[model samples]
Target: MPNHVAVNPRDHKDLRILEERSEGMGDATMCCITFPEEFRNLQNHYTILFQLDQEREAFNCLAMFGLENGENLFLDNGRWDASYVPLAMDIQPFMIGRPSDHDADRKVVIDSDSPRIGKGEGRRIFDDNGIPTAYLESISNKLSHLDGGYRASSEYIDCLKKYDLLEPLSIDVTMKDGAKNRLVGFHVIHEERLNKLSAEGLAELQSKGYLMPSYMALASLSNLSKLIARKEAAAINV
Candidate 1:
């Protein structure tokens, strides 16, 4: 099944209209990550996750507000038996962010079991430099009392704030009870100045079918990046 069909065949013109009328953010591309068990058959951009969920789909969605085709897709699949959607790009920079031995002290705990976390085994830790990372058993004894996953470390969040990039934006989960939950997970730390794009930047982005973007989406990725970097640094230094 196709992901999105224009209500009007002439809506193809709307793509140009959308390109020109896109506000807030200059031009955003769709970042769709699918879980093999869910969206193994679907492959289309601009589809709604909830609708996809209703259609028995399983995929994560992100509006990559500012990106060029050649950029890396940095992501971590913390769960087992999970397949990450490939961005059809080079794998040089794409890595599974994990924890480290130095973080043998850091832990991730959840309060409720009703949510039924699947990948509750260990933590992926990053090194100080934020490049290479490792994984270890979560050490926090207090985590059994919290709901959802534990909030990422403050160190991770602060660094993400510094880079000023877009985040995973949203999470769409279809529970066992057939209910879909859209958790606005990450904070949108920055919003684009749509009315303020420089003529040159806009022209360049437009010509290349890319936009440098004014706003950035943020999530726990910064911490994951931090943990990876920290672990790599620790390993190298050791």
Candidate 2:
């Protein structure tokens, strides 16, 4: 858990956050919550897939980092291998929070306990005049975009569910060193069913911008080969 507090220029005018993308600074995770808006960039380097969150009873886009659990293959020598990093990953210790007292109030909250947050030698969140810096404004905009993207992503997932276009996926692979990896429990877009949809159904998806994200996800399947090659390279170097 992170210790979060509302960010205010009056009290935290000198807040500085570490901007370096380094391991142990919070990028060690094997997967991250992604969205349809991110599918295009994600397809270039990472496998884009939808995962069901049983607790929330909704689907979220996930960008996979490794074949199995806890192994982040994209972390090469403490550096991320991809040219495009997801916004969810870029948001870092700052997150959008809605106050319970106010129904529609959205505010920026920072994890004061995060190692990234420090007093010296980092990106300043506010200027000496207590105005938000360009970097801070960018983070605020990204978080706001993410908030809206998630709502649309949920509706898109519901559409796929309504048409029964999502199917369970399982993949079994044999690594070069005779290690077996069996990945299961993730849901994938049903390409066969997708192709056989009615004209009206196709039009609905196309009009809503859902069609492109679906194809982007299917295209990401080719990245499995890239994942395997990276795994092989890691194994060889070991």
Please, what are the lDDT tens digits per residue for candidate 1 over residues 100-211? Answer: 6755543332222211112422222333443223221121211221111112212223332344423335645443445444545333333353335567645654454323
lDDT of 2 by residue, 53-134 (tens): 9999888889888887777787766567789878887888898887887677799998888878866878888999999999
Candidate 2: the clashing residue pairs are: none
Mark the regions of model 2 whose C-alpha exceeds 4 Å error after superposition: none
lDDT of 1: 0.28
Q: Candidate 2 at residue 92, lDDT?
A: 88
What is the Cα-based TM-score of model 2?
0.93
Collision count for each candidate, in order: 26, 0
